[model samples]
Structure formats: structure tokens, C-alpha cells
Target: MTSRDTDATTDATTDAAAREHATATTAATGPAATAADAPVTISYEEIDGARIAVVSLNRPAKLNGLTMAMLRGLDDAAATLRRDRDLRGVIFAGAGNSFCAGLDFGSVLKKPMDIVKAFAPNPLAGDGANLFQRVCWEWRRLPAPVIAVVHGHCYGGGVQLALGADFRVTAADARWSVLEAKWGLIPDMSGARTLADHVGAEQARWLTMTGRELSGAEAVEVGLATETTESLDDAHSRARETLRELMGRSPDQLAATKSLFNHAWRSPRATFRAERFEQAKLLLSENAARARTAAMKKTPPNFVRRGTWAFGAKKK
Candidate 1:
């Protein structure tokens, strides 16, 4: 984390088939990952001159379906990114054709212990996040903005995971759905909190209850997608363009901007209070000072990297 040159770290399990097709290269050229690391389900690669973390879900055969291992990997990836001070943006995408098909119900049902372990009550409840919720919430909690690149099938937990991102870009023909209704469940993985942010409460209710599917263009109309394109390549191009634009600005400012809108709906007074407090901190930051100096000189700013700041931390 001290240096952006480090390659994508592997903490997830990968199956043979997935590994054969998936290629992850880091600047450091990490050692060959063990099979213990199977379905090679999650990975992080730096893009756009090491300013963006491209988090990939590598289970292409299963449409990158969620398993207990994949969920844990995502949590680890988030933790790693949380500590990275230099990261300006994040891109979450899936390997193969679909983003993610949803949870692997058959695999999950076979392993009841994994379910129990996932739901086990925490004694301290740090940040009130469990394994399942953390997979989605961690992206929202990051200081940098997260953009999800969606294509093919994005369903159930997949939808929730994308919802956790700051922005979503999808292929025009991609299929999206809140598929939990068919499985006799609700979206317990932070979907309820995030879905409302993108769409109205009524739309969220109908999607969750009926488990209907929507096309990428339809998602944009309904606010589920920030934008849609004719092809997946075009969606990725847009994400890279956004990252390039954001990387030029102060990282702290970007984080503060995300904070403002994320909290706007929950509490108006608190949101206003947060604005003043965040601005005060930003005004005092070394990066902000550099930004101001550069602005006066009519030059591109060379702002300093920001340290990690947790969500809801009280500012001095």
C-alpha cells in the first residue's frame, strides 16, 4: 500500500478452469498463487498509472457467482484498498461474459457451516458489518469512488454488489435483476440501503419483491446504471475516462464529495454539519494548499497523497 507499483494481491480461492483463463499481472510479478487460493475468485490490479484499483471477480464459468470464499476475498480486497492512501478510484468488474450471476445457491446450500459462520454475531460489532454485508458496504465506505462495470447477467447479490459502487456502467444488452425473490429471500447484503439511493423507494420495492430483470438501458432510465453503452468495451472506456479525470483532482475532495451525497438522504442536518466539518479539514490539508497554489499559478496541481480516513470519524 505504501507504493502503487505493487501488483494485485491474491487472497481468494480459484478453480483450475478459472485460473487457466484468468491472467493477473502486477508490477512486482507476484509468485504463483496456490490452488488453495481456487476459483481465483477475486483480485485487484492497478490501472491508469496506478491510480485506479481494478477489482475483478474471476469465476467466469459460473458467471462469477458468489461463494463464501469469494465474499471473504472481497472483504480482504476492500481492507487492502482502505489502507491505500494513493488510490484515486476503483473499478469493480467480473471475468468472462457476466458480471455475476448471483450467489451459488447449490454450493451454499451444501455448506451450512459457511452460512452459520457468515451470520455469527460479533461481540463488538465493529462498524456493524458482517461478512455478507461487508462485501458490498466496503466499497461504499472507501475514500475513493468505486465504479461498477456491468455486463451479461447481474442478479441478486451481484446487483447489490454493484449498488455498493459510486457509479455503475453497463453494456446495452446486459441483463440485471433482483433475483432473490425466486430464492425466497430478501437482499440482506446491504442492497436495501443502496438500492434506494439509485431508484425511488417504490421501484426498489417492486424490483426486490417481484425479482424482475431489466436491460442496461432500462437500468439507466431507472437510475440503476449511471450510463449504458453499445458494448462492454465502450463501458470500460468510459470508466477509464472517468478515472483519468478524477485522478487529476485532490483525493480528499473526491472522498468528501462522495460523503456528501451518500449521507444526503439519511439526515439533512447531519449532512450539512458534515459539509462544514469536511471542508474545514480539507482547507487545512497539505494537498488542498498545493491545489490552491497551483490554481493561482494556472498549473495542474501536484497534490499530496491522502492518508486513510474511516467513515463517520469525528473531525477535529
Candidate 2:
């Protein structure tokens, strides 16, 4: 056979495989899977000279149910925000009525290869996080504080996503659940780590095993949510207020505080060392000096942008 003919045959074989995969995926996932085409929206809201990023899950018709594509979009959004030194905070919200209904199994299962890829650990990531874990844990890695404004249904993966944030401001009427138990699965999307920070072992076990739903008020009582508001609007406002309060402080100090708590919690020796190390760094920082001057003058601090820090730094 001629070289050109052989090349054409190879191209035909590749095209046939592509078509087969697409057909199988469509048949398995149905037409609703097309909803994954909607992108997660990332917009910047400038509040008091600080850049606040708002990441809205866009599949409203599905109650912001997570599909493989949506998961990828969320990870990409977090990565983009991580590089922004000027970012003061991030607000995670859902479009339409609900916050998130959790993972859309039908959509994700259709692309079986995607699931395997998401489950595998990323070699370059020091945290040993896979794609699914990164969708939640990446928020914790960001220097800026992250607040999840929850309303409507937040279940399974959705709840895990909220747990990853520094704070969760939930609407009084919102429904929160572990949800994976219903499907005979455990909360594997970094929920095991973050949930422990908020609630005790027994409570976490009960929530995971029973898949019981919690009202926003109950979530706070159990330490799942940072606070509950009368309404979704109130929750958003509360989150903004919290952001403003945090933004008033030195950015480096805030970053240090987050790192200290995240890494040093539950260990006396680690916590003490972290406190001293972070204090040393902050005491010498330009923002710290600005903070001192502003406090003495009773005026707002004009601090410089945040500096780079070693993320997930190990304790000595």
C-alpha cells in the first residue's frame, strides 16, 4: 500500500473510534448531559479596593449538579484564582435556585475514562490530591479566604465543597446532607479531612453513615456551617461583611492565620511552632508595619499586595 493510503486508513480508524466514544457517551448519559456545556462563571467584584472573586456554578436547571466538565471547570477556576495576589476573597455560590444538588452520576459515569482520571492522584501536587479532591481542597490552598454562600439543596459533593471553604454562610432554609451514604458510598472528595475540623468524630460518622439532612440552623449547631442567616440574601451580605472585616487586616497576616489554623490544628507543638514562625514573618512584613501605623492613627491601612508563601509547608 502507498504511504498516503496508509495514513488515510489510520486517520479513518481514529475518526471511527472518536465517533464510537461519543455515541456511547450520549446513549449512556442522555440529552441532559449536554447541560455540562454551560461554563462555571467567574466574575470579579471590586469591594473597597479589594478584588473579590465570585465563582457561580452555572447548571441551574440541574440544581448545579456536578458533571465531569463542571468539576474540571471548578478546578480550573480555583487554579486561576490562586495566582491572583490581589484577590481578597472568593465567594462560592450557585446559579438559579439551588446551591448544588451534588454529583450528577449519570453525566459523569457516561465518561468512564474521565472518572478514572479524576480519581488518580496528581504527581505534581504536594498534597496528593486528585481531580475530585482538588475541586474542594484547592480553595483551602488559596491565600485569600473563601466563603461558601449556601442556599437550597447542598448534598454529597456539594457539602464537601462547602466544607473546603474557610467559612460557610448558609441560608436558614437551606438543606445540607452527606448524601453519599444513600448511594452506598463514603464522602471521598476531601470531606473526610475538612469535616473533622468542624465536627467531632461521632457527629461526622453519624452524618456520613446515615446521610441525614440538616437544616442551616442545625448545621451551625453541629458546627457544619459558620453561621446561618434568615435568608439567602442575608447569607450573601453576611459573607461580604466578613470579607470586609478580613480585608481590613494585613493580607499577609490573614494568609498566615489561615495557614496556621489549617496546618497546626490539634497539635500543641506544631501549633506553637507555626505561631512563632508566622509571627516572625508577619512582624517583618510591610503590611504588618502598615497595620501598626493605621491602628495608632485610627485610620484604614493601605497595605501592599500579598506575597508568595510556601503552601502546605511542613512543620519542623
Candidate 3:
């Protein structure tokens, strides 16, 4: 064959392979989204020498409603963040006015089998969380803190998504609700864990059963939010301020702190044991010694980078 003919054949083969791969991936997950059509977008930057990941729900005309594509995009972003040890924090936001309205019931309701597939349990995941659950749960277990900047509507699945963050800063006029009850369902995502922890069991049950709307201020009062601002810019400012304060701490301590507090929600025996175990692990680290020296000298400590540390079976 002529060289030109050979190149044309090769190009055709590559195009066919790409199309096949895209089709398979879409079938396994859901719809495909290109940069122009994506429901979610993730970006990162270094702020004050700290790496911060930013995740945005980009379907604004529909108020950033949750779709399989958006969920998968978010899950993929969370997975990426989990592996980045240099990441100091994450800011979860939505493009345009709202963070997220809720599930796009219009699309999801038409795909019963797809819903089942999304929830298929995984044996390797100790908690039995499927794809739907991991999108939220992963944020909770992320090595760095996640701060959600909320504005406008945050209902149902949106509420669950925000709950996954360590701190949620919402605009005072933003709407918040536990809306599944209104749709004849329940908050089946990891919202249950976050709600039970943030608000006590009684309040969690009441809110879930009622599905009533709460203003951002009321959300803070009810323990569903960390703080409320006058506007979206204010929310971002608050998150940035919090991130700056957090950047001063050692990553090991931050991870250990999150783990220790998370353990607090468990049995007393487990909590105590985890406390001792985490302390022991941290105590043996060279970073801990550096921290001590820095404290004595009143200077910033140059501890070991986060991903470099390994502690027994805990090193995932």
C-alpha cells in the first residue's frame, strides 16, 4: 500500500478504537459529557503554597441537578483528590446561581435499571458502598478537608452532597431541605451518616420525615450548615479564610484529626482504641518531632510531605 493509504488506514483504526472505548465507558457509567456538555468540572490551583482542588457542578440552567454523568464526574474527581497527598483542601461549588437543586428525577425516573446498576454493592468496599454512595462518602474520607460553598437551592441529593464536606458555608438566603420525603423516598446516600452525626438522631429523623425547607440561617441553627454568609462571594471568602488557617497545620495531624473525630461517632471502645492507635502512629513519625522543635522555636515547621508517610496497614 502507498504510505498515504497506510496513514489513512491507521487513522481510521484509531478513530474506531476511540469510539469503541467511549461507548463501553458510557454503557458502564451513564451518558458521556464532553467539556462543552459536561455537568461537572474540576480544577486545581496552588494558593499560598497549598494545593486546593475545586469541583464545580456546571449544569446551571437546570440548577445543577444531579444526573448520572454529573455523579460519575464528581466521583472521578474525588478519586483523583484522594490520591493527591499535596492537596491541602477542596472547595466544592456550583457554577452560576445554585449549588444543586436535587436529583434530575425527570431523567433518573425513566431509568430504573440504571439506578439499580448504580447501587450494586461492592464486596471490596468494607462499608458496602456502591458508586452512588462513594461520590459523597469519598469526600468525607478524603485526606484533606472539603469546604462546600453553597448558594441558592440545595435540596435532597444536593443536601447529601454538601453534607459530605467537612464545612458547608452557605448564603443566608440560600434554600436548604431534606426533600426525599416529598418525592416518596428517603435520603439513601451517605447523607444518613452525615445527618446522624451533624444533628443527632432525633433531629435527623424529624427532618427526613418532614422534608421541610430551611433557610441558610436556619440550616446553621439546625446543624445542617457550618456558617451562612450574606452572598456567594462572602461564602467564598469564608472558605478561603478557613483554608488559610488550615494550611498552617501538618497534613498528618489533619488526617489523624479527621480520622479521630470520625471514630468518635462509633462505639466507645473503638473510639478509644483508634485514638491511641492514631496517636501512636503520629508520635513515631519524624514530622511529629519536627513539629515539636518548631513549637519550641516558634517557627513554621517543615514536616514531611503527606504522601511520603506510611503507617502499617493504614497506608492505602
For candidate 3, write residues 113-143 as lDDT tens digits: 8888888978898889987788888888898
Residue 297, model 2, lDDT: 100
TM-score of 1: 0.83
Pairs of residues at least 3 apart in sequence or in different chains that clash in candidate 3:
none
lDDT for 181 in candidate 3 is: 84
Q: In candidate 1, what are the lDDT values of residues 1-316, reduced to their tens digit? A: 0001112232333322223323374221113444233443344444545566667776666777877777777877788888888888887887677787788765676788888888664557665766787788889889998989898888888898999999998999999888888767888887888888789899999988988889999999988899998987788778777877887788888887877776767577888898898888787676677677778999987655784233333432
Instruction: Please give the range of 10 consecutive residues that has the lowest summed lDDT in model 1.
Output: 1-10
Candidate 2: tens digits of C-alpha lDDT, residues 219-290: 999999999999877888888889999989889988888888877455798888888988988877778777
- Models ranked on TM-score: 3, 2, 1
lDDT on C-alpha atoms for all candidate structures: 0.74, 0.77, 0.75
Using all chains and alpha carbons, the TM-scores for the candidates as numbered come to 0.83, 0.83, 0.85
**Among all candidates shown, the one with the greatest TM-score:** 3
* Alpha-carbon shift of residue 219 in model 3 (angstroms): 0.7
Candidate 3 or 2, higher lDDT: 2
Query: Is 2 or 3 the stronger prediction by TM-score?
Result: 3
Q: After superposing candidate 2, which stretches have Cα over 4 Å from the reference? A: 1-37, 265-269, 308-316
